[model samples]
Target chain A: MKPRVLAGLLTLALVPAAAGAASLGLGVYGGMSSPILNDTAGNGPQYGVRAPVTLAPMLIVEPFYAQSALGDVDQSFGGSSYTRSGPDVKMFGANAVFSFGEGVKFYPLVGIGSTKITQSGWADITDTSLNFGLGFGFRPMAKLCVDVRGELNAVVTGDTSRKFGNLTAGVSYALFGSE
Target chain B: MKNLRLILPSLLLTGLMASGCWLISGQFTVSQDLPTPLDVDSQIVIVGAHIDLNTQSTYRDHKNDLKDLADCALLGTFTNTGTGTLDILVYMTPAGSPLHSTKVQLDADATKIKVWGPLTLGPGASKKVGWDESAGLFNADGKQALLKEVKGDGDFALYAVGASAPYKLRLTDGVAVVVVDAGK
Candidate 1:
């Protein structure tokens, strides 16, 4: 994971010479995440922060951290009588973005992260997987912005599997004083 | 339209992922409503003892009957109003000891026994927890020892937590006689 983060930073660092421009920005945002579907355990709000470094006008890389509940996997079929708790899971990942200019930006981002879920009466469930984000952001103001993103996370457990997705809108404050 | 295109694929993938996984077993439902106790004039004998499991009956048929003559089974019933889930456990204190102990997940209610032993319930939607119907005795030692002293008109501090109301069965000369004398 450290290697991946270094590679992303290196790409952002060297992009100005090759891609004609560079822009570095830091932002903070909070929003809700819903575990819709067979999501029986957790369906609540999620909050996080992202630091996006732009390389040229079309390219950007963001490293982020979020605290959220990704919902529970039903353990009743495994002969256990207890309900598994969708413990608070922490995620760390980086995304690559492609902006189409104006207030609209469309990007296909990929990252690797892990989520740890604890059960009510048993051991915790730790999952590592790849997560993807494909969506567009709206910069309604130059320094203040509104972004809508769709995320898909595929989590792999020892005995079972689970997935989570969220379509969220956020209000972000740019620390670089530029959008 | 743009948002729809992005979210639709993931939604479809999540459906596939949810369908591929297995859910762990054991369904539990808890109810706070108290079940009415079964009223019987017959002597309700209580007996239980914490005897060594090595001496316990394993034949499936006699597992509920007193083994090594140690425990007592508390017997009573609740009139069925509707069907739901129940949790059951047994409480015991050694002879002349004030501290009481219980087996882990040792409670029984309407459907099943949580004990590591066989899931035993007689022929109906409901089953008796402590008494062995076939052998006419308490299910095991732990139950026998608890009721050994209930052989006469005496009130002993007992503990029982079930889906039914926490109850204390009154012991009469008739009710106490059901418990066989297990000398402490």
Candidate 2:
């Protein structure tokens, strides 16, 4: 692990476990994602615990780690029996989510995070990307809420690269926060 | 051969430089949809599969095939098929010929399939695949070095399906153990 990444993860992990005024949540998320390589669609399963440290009523910082599969993509030639399978892509990231709204009914959110993606079968062929996410959540109770999210991850590799996106919906159990 | 030697050393260096560690855990279940067989004591099924090695060079050179390939389980028997029994084949199938099968057994639980060896169950019985690892892959030390040496490109799939339903009895339950070396 790089020094910066280590520092980032440590900082996020130690996010003042005291749920003071902020909202802490943990959940598992899974859904379909359009991979950057070759595939019609693939399943991505992610499990993470998120804690929001609110700088203000509308701004919160959330850090997360997730393992996802890009699925087996077909890259083999048309007539060749020798077909190739794509490796699974595992990722981890931390984001700053900006929520907008007042009443505890509904709120819209947008955020950005730095992501580290690892490709199986291809060791060291890793990608560190800047991802932007847009989503919303509704909290009907004091400790429970549901959120739907989508993110566009742009990975930079010296010269040419691509943008990948994933959309998922999940329910969260809050340790503390306003209803 | 000279170029191959040079490339091999460079690849080794690259692998060393990129070495880190990983912890992976997940659950996989195979639900078979086949007709049940009638009048049978028990039945067994085998499932074999290989993990994918994603790379263009490996795919072209067939390096992925060099790694040792083996399935932990042998065969599982489903015996409680009272009126009739349904036998179905389940496993990740390879793309090309010479299909591989990972044999599994019916665990004592009767609901889950214990993939270690042969298992016996009565008629009308279904089983799910389950495995547990406490420490995980990271505990394997530098064994990841072995992963680098494995370079053949292959995808997982159900290669063969030979099950006996209650109405039609086709094949009987059996066990087969084979060790596959990459060089072979």
Candidate 3:
């Protein structure tokens, strides 16, 4: 099936599920992301928004949109130095989060999504990839939750691929449920 | 509960597989300086002159068509030949008028030819400078102003003012009458 059709179907399925979920949480997050592959010196800030739907006592599905700022990289080739400024990236994806415990819960998430990178003086590149992450969340008050996560995203285009790691912190409001 | 245990392990395995280097595309580099031979103090002379026509075209329905673009570039090369450094101001004025009277001092060695600069020389040094014909002349404020296009054929003169030790040097080259005949 076409990726767009599959994405549309997933969105349709989520609407009903989210409407009947036990709770929904909306949050904003900011973080640092670093390239793990070639020329790893280009690291930048990433910020995003996410909405989480609690389907059952320990199961949650979250969809997110995140963007990374333009990063500058200095490279030396053949004894000459050149500066590369950009390749800012944007990611849109959804994850199935599995919560292990209450109050302070540890969750492992598996996700899939698309990423687009735009660099100055070069054509833009877009690809789809799989995401993996581990996070911990704590609720100190009834409506307030704080979470931290470490995530890895593997982006694949044709036969080549690259990976990026993100360490993020977020705050969420319960909106409609108890933690 | 049994299903949960199985699903958790499977998810963990997928996560591990997905976590690794894989998230960038092509990189582009912008070149700031051109590669030219560096020589010591050499006689400052105009080596070449030409009018470059900038052209463009597009492809449509398996056919390529040219676009109407009249931009051109004025190119020249200046060579310096002296044991001592020579501070010079090289500029272009309307073919017959006195070189723009605005005199600016050269403060640094690497100043752009668009402004007054110290062109240091040891024994042989040369540099190539060019201006976009459409950019017109440099104003008193050291900024490009008076945008003008080359019309048919016109004559433009190149002049250089330099000071080396006891003697001040001023040299003017024959007028360069640029014939704007782009692509017959």
Candidate 4:
């Protein structure tokens, strides 16, 4: 589906949860993303915001949007080499999280998202893919938590597909929860 | 819940394997416009041309010297600045001969010995072409001949005739002599 339509659906899904839910956490995260494909994109910094809403004691749904900074790619044609630099990438997705334990929590996450990569010289590439992640969270206080996660994003564009890995750290604050 | 635990880990493991060191493929297409042609008064010119000599040398301990063998190649670019499509023909003929001095009008059906191209360049577009010496020489009738039997070093001139009416341009820069020695 188109990214804008997916975004609208996500927003609509979040509004009622934010209004009536007993548990909701808002988070901001930053991390390093390494392109794992062979000579496709470069490693760069990514930052994003997420909102997690608890549905059951061990289940949560998180919707997030992340943007990665410019990266470089080298291209060669007919014995000549050219450097294609500064492609900015953006990702939007929703994840289902299954948490275990309290105070210290471990979660396994599965998601689906769309990635848009844009550069100056070449045409824009946009595609959707699946996401997988493993995360750990530490709750020091009733309303504060620290989280670290490693995520893998798989996207395909034009006859080539690549998987990128992101390692991120962040803090979340419970705005409205059963504190 | 126990079954869910087993299923999630299995799915995650599958995702990891799929995203890792494996090759994935897809395809897309992009298009761009052709370059515009130059004015009618402008001509097609030989921007740059060069002959490159690639040599390999090895040390001979018995002879106390190095022996080298070289291969010759011609590389150049031609630009058409005229309003019409440029048709070009390149020739390597003996320098300072009547054939070299002779001016032939650009004709669609003209034939010549050792012709390089009937290359067509759109207006304002530039084309680069290269030829290697080992590729064998050809006569006007496209018969193969040995390079040594043709003409020797510096004995030949490389010239091109570009026709893009109402202009016919003849271009020849001084012959380029470049030697690249790969000696070990």
Fnat, model by model in order, equals 0.05, 0.00, 0.09, 0.10
lDDT of 4 by residue, B1-184 (tens): 3454456457656754665522242111111111122112323332212221111121111112111111122234456656678776555443322233233322222333454556677777765443322112223232221132121231233445554345444231122221111111
Of the two candidates 1 and 4, the one with more favorable lDDT, higher being better, is: 4
Tens digit of per-residue lDDT, candidate 3, span A1-179 = 44335444655667887888888989899999887642423789999998887887778877788899746665443234334453688877777788898679999888766787775422356766567899999987887789999998766654345567899999887689754
- DockQ for candidate 2, C-alpha atoms: 0.02
True contacts kept of 4: 0.10
Q: What lDDT does model 1 reach?
A: 0.41
Q: Which candidate is the best by TM-score?
A: 3
Angstrom error at residue A115, model 3:
1.1
lDDT of candidate 2 over A1-179, digit per residue (tens):
55347437644554653345355656556655555432222445444455555444555555565555655432222121111233354455555555676543333333323444443322233555445667777776667767788875544332223346677776667655642
Write down the TM-score of model 1's second chain: 0.27
Q: Give the interface RMSD values of the models in order.
A: 18.1, 18.3, 14.6, 15.6
Query: For this target, which candidate reaches the highest DockQ against the unseen true structure?
Result: 4
Predicted complex 4: CAPRI docking category: incorrect
Model 4: lDDT of residue A92 = 85
**Native-vs-model 2 lDDT?**
0.38
Q: Interface Cα RMSD for candidate 2?
A: 18.3
Tens digits of per-residue lDDT for model 4, A29-134: 9998887632435688989998887766677767888888756654332243334354578988777778898778999888766788775523466776557889
**TM-scores for all candidates?**
0.42, 0.42, 0.52, 0.52
DockQ, all candidates in order: 0.04, 0.02, 0.06, 0.09
**Of candidates 3 and 2, the better by lDDT:** 3
C-alpha lDDT of residue B85 in model 4: 82
Q: Which stretches of candidate 2 lie over 4 Å from their true place?
A: A1-21, A37-47, A76-78, A102-121, B1-184
